[model samples]
Target: MEQAEIGLIGLGVMGSNLALNIAEKGNKIAVFNRTQEATKKFYAEAGALQSQIIPCETLEEFVAAIRPPRPIIIMIKAGDPVDQQMELLKPYLSAGDIMIDAGNANFRDTMRRFDSLKDSPLTFIGMGVSGGEEGARHGPSIMVGGTEESWKRVEKVLTSISAKFNGDPCVAWLGNDGAGHFVKTIHNGIEYADMQMIAEIYGILRDGLKLSAPEISKVFGNWNTGRLNSYLIEITEKVLAAADPITGQPMVDVILDAAGQKGTGKWSVIEAQNLGVAATGIEAAVAGRILSSQKAERVEAEKILGLPDTLAFPAVDGVAFLKDLESALLAAKIGAYAQGFAVMAAASKEYGWHLPMPTIAKIWRAGCIIRSQFLDEITSAFTKDPDVANLIVTPAFAALVKETDGALRRVVSTAALAGLPVPALASALSYFDSYRRSRGTANLIQAQRDFFGAHGFDRVDGVDKHHGPWGSGAAIY
Candidate 1:
C-alpha cells in the first residue's frame, strides 16, 4: 500500500493520459472521476503502468491517498465545473496543499478563482497544457501560473513530463494568477489565423488553380521540408493525401466544409477588443469560422446572387504561383504572430502578469500546434529586444517583409480578382499597411466624427482639440 505521490481528478482523455504520463515518469499517481466506471476502465487498460495507479473511488479516499502538502491536478471542464470540483474537494484538503487547473479556461476566471482561494491555505493555480491527445500521452508544452512557492513544489515533476525544444523543457512558471492562460489564449488565436491562412491557400490550390487533392498534398509535403515545417502542416499533408476508401475520393472533399471551434478563437478576438489592440487577423479568422458555419444560407445565397462558377479559374504559371503562394503564407503568418503577441503584451500590462514574451516563443517552438521553425527566429528577435512593440519592426522580420511583401500583395489582389475569399490573409496585409504608414486617412474619419457626433478632432500641431464648423458650429451635446 504505497501512497500516491499526486492526485489526479477527472479521468477524461487529457486527464487519463496525463496520469499515465506521470506514472510513466516513475511517479505513483492517484486517480478519480465523477463516476466509478471511468476510473475502473482506466486501471483495467493501464497495461504495465497499472501498478503505479492508485484507484480512489471517493474524494476523501483520493485526498487521503496523496502524500502531505498534496498536489492535485484537475482536468475537468473549465468555468462552473471547476468551481463545483473545488467546492467538493474543499472539505478534504488541508491548508498547504495546492490545486492546479490544467484547462483552456478564460484567464479572467482563473484570476477570480485564484483570488477567492486566498482566504484558505489551498493555493489555486492556472496552467495551460497544449498538444492534442497524442502529445498529452507523450509530452506537451506546459505553462503554469501560480505563486513562487507553489511552483517550487511541483516544478521538477512538470518539467520532466513536458516536451523539450532543443533539449530545453517546454514548461515555465509565468507570472502569478492568469498569465499562463492569457498566453495560451493568444497562442490559440495565432493558431486560428495560421489555420485560416492554410485553408485559404488550400482553397486557392483546389478551386482557383484546379489542382487535385493529391497534387496539393505534394505541395504541402514540399513546404514541410522548408521554413513552413510545422505540426499543422504535417497533419494537413496527411489529411489531404488520404483517400476515402468507400467513395474513392479525396477524404477532405467528403467531409463537411463547416469548421467548428471550442470558443478559444472567439475569446481571443473578444480579449483583443477589450485591450484595444489590433488583432484583425484573428478577428477575420473567427469571422471566417462563423461564416463557414452558415452552409445552408451560403448555398441558397449563391443560387440567388449568381456568383461565378469556380470552373473559370485562371491558367497561371505553376512554378511562379507556388513561389508567390509560399511568400504570401509566410507574410500572413508574420502578421498574425505580430498581432497575437501585441494582444499578449496588452493583456500582460493590464493584468500585471509581467509575462515573458521571449520565453513564450521558446516554449512554443515545439509541442504546441503552432510550433514552427518561425518561432526560432521569433525567440531570437524577442531575446534581443524583450520590450519590442511589434515583431514586424524587428530587423529579422523587417528583412523578411522586404523579401515577401510583393508576393503577399500579389496573392491578395489575385485572390480578389479571382473572386476567391482570403479574409485572414487580406486582414494581415491591411494591418501591416496601416502599421507602416506614417499618416493615415483617419483624420477624415475624425472630421466626420467631429461633424456628426461632435467628437473633437486634434489639429496638425497634435495639440488643441477643436469642434468643426458644421451648420451652426454648435459644440452642444
Candidate 2:
C-alpha cells in the first residue's frame, strides 16, 4: 500500500469526521485510536473512503503508515493528556516530522509545548479548528501557528479541507507558537458575548413583550435576513420554533435555564485583563453563565424576596419596540467584537506574533460559529487601516456606532427600569459611552486612589504635582 500523506490520532467525533474529510478530499490518511475497537469501528464506517483510510491500532503503525516528514494531528483531550500523547509519539517521529495539536488548548500551554520540542527535530504546531462537528466533516476555519517551513509542508492539505468564502480558503498560518490558539480563544470569547446579547433580546421579547415562542421565532427569522444575518440568529429562529414531543411545550421552554461552560470564556477575560484590555462584554457573558448555574440559589432568593416591584415592561408601541431590540442587538454585538479584536491586537503585540488582523477577520467570515457578514466588513476596515488603535474608532465602525447607539441606549434604559437583567447588553452600551467620550470620570478615581494608596496620577496641565493634599490627617506629597 502507498504511504498516507497525513496521519491522525484519536477516533473521537471531531477526529473521526476530520479524517473522513481528509480521505474524501483524495488525501490518503492513516488514523489511530488508543483503543483498537474504536479504530476498527471508524474504518468500518468509512465505507467508500475506507480504501483511502489506513487504520492503525499502534503508534508505530500509525507513524510508519504515513510518508516521510510526516504531519500528524493529535486531536484529544487537552492539558496533560496532550503532553503524555506527544511524549509517547516523539520516539516514533523522525526529523522534520510535525506534531499538530488541534484541541481547544490554552495558548500558554501551546507555547510551552512548542518550547518543549524546540531543541528536537520534531516541530510542533498549535492549530485552532472551528465550525464544530459539521465543519469538521466538511470544512472548518483553520488557524495555524508554527515554523513557516512546517506550515508550508501542511498548507496544501489544510487549504484543501478548509471552508471557503468567495473562493478564499478560511485558513492561514497566523504566527508562531501560541498565536493560533490565542486567536481562537478570542473567537470564543466574542461568541459568548454574542450569544448572551441574543438571549437578552429573547428575554425582552418573551418576558417583556409577552410574545410566544413561535412569535419570537418569527422575529429572529426576520432579523436573519437583515444586518444580524448569521448562523446564530438562523438557529435561534429554528430552536425557538421547535416543540418538545414529550411535554408538548416549546423546546426552549422545556429546557433548563442554566448554561454550562468549558473555561474558554473565562480564559478570554483573564488574558484580556492581563493585557490591560477591557473585555466587559465577554466578562458579562461569563458572569451570566455563572449566575445562571446558581439556579437553586436564585429560586430560593426569589421565594424569599420576590420579583422586583417595577413593571416587567412598561407599555410601549409594540412595533417600534421590536425594532429597537433588533438595533440594540446589533449595536451591542459591535462592542463585543471590537473588544475581542482589541484583546487579540494586544496579544499579538505582547507575544510578538504580528498576527494578521485582516486575515483573521477574512477567514472568520465563514466556517466559524461567529461567521457573519459583519466580519467581512471588519476585514475591509483592517485591510484599510491595520494599525488602527481600536476597531471602534475606524471610519466604517464609527458611523455604525453613531447610527445604532441610540437604540442600544433606549433598550438598555428600558430594561433597567423594567428590572430585567441585561448585563451583557448594558456592558456594551457602557463600553461605547466610555470609549467615545473625550474625558471620563476616572479623574475622580485617580484622585481617590492617590488619596487612599498614594498611587500617583498624571496631571492634565503642565503642573508636575502627582499627588493631592488630602485636607485631613494624611500627609501632603
What's the lDDT for candidate 2? 0.93
Q: How would you encode candidate 1's per-residue C-alpha lDDT over 1-477 as one tens digit per residue?
A: 788888899999999989999899888899999999999999999999999999989999999999878999999998899989988999999988989899899988989999998888899888899997877888899988988888888887788789898899898998899888888888999999999999999999998898899999999999999978888889899999999999999999999999999989999999999999999999999999999999999999988987765446667788999999998999999999999999988888998888888999999987889999889999999999988999999999999987889999989988888889999999988988999999999989988888778888889986675877678755445
| TM-score computed on alpha carbons, candidate 1 | 0.97
What TM-score, computed on C-alpha atoms, does each candidate reach? Answer: 0.97, 0.98
Give the local distance difference test score of model 1: 0.90
User: Residues 1-477, candidate 2, lDDT per residue (tens digit)?
Assistant: 899999999889999999998999999999999999999999999999999999998899899999989999999998999999999999899999999999999999999999988898889999999999999999999999899999999998999999999999999999999999999999999999999999999999988898999999999999999999998998999999999999899999989999999988999999999999999999999999999999999999999998888855898899898899999999999999999999999999999999999999998988899998799899999999999988899999999989999999999999989888999999999999999789999999998888877887999996988988786844435
Q: Residue 416, candidate 2: how far off, in angstroms? A: 1.0
lDDT for 355 in candidate 1 is 83
lDDT accuracy of residue 386 in candidate 2: 96
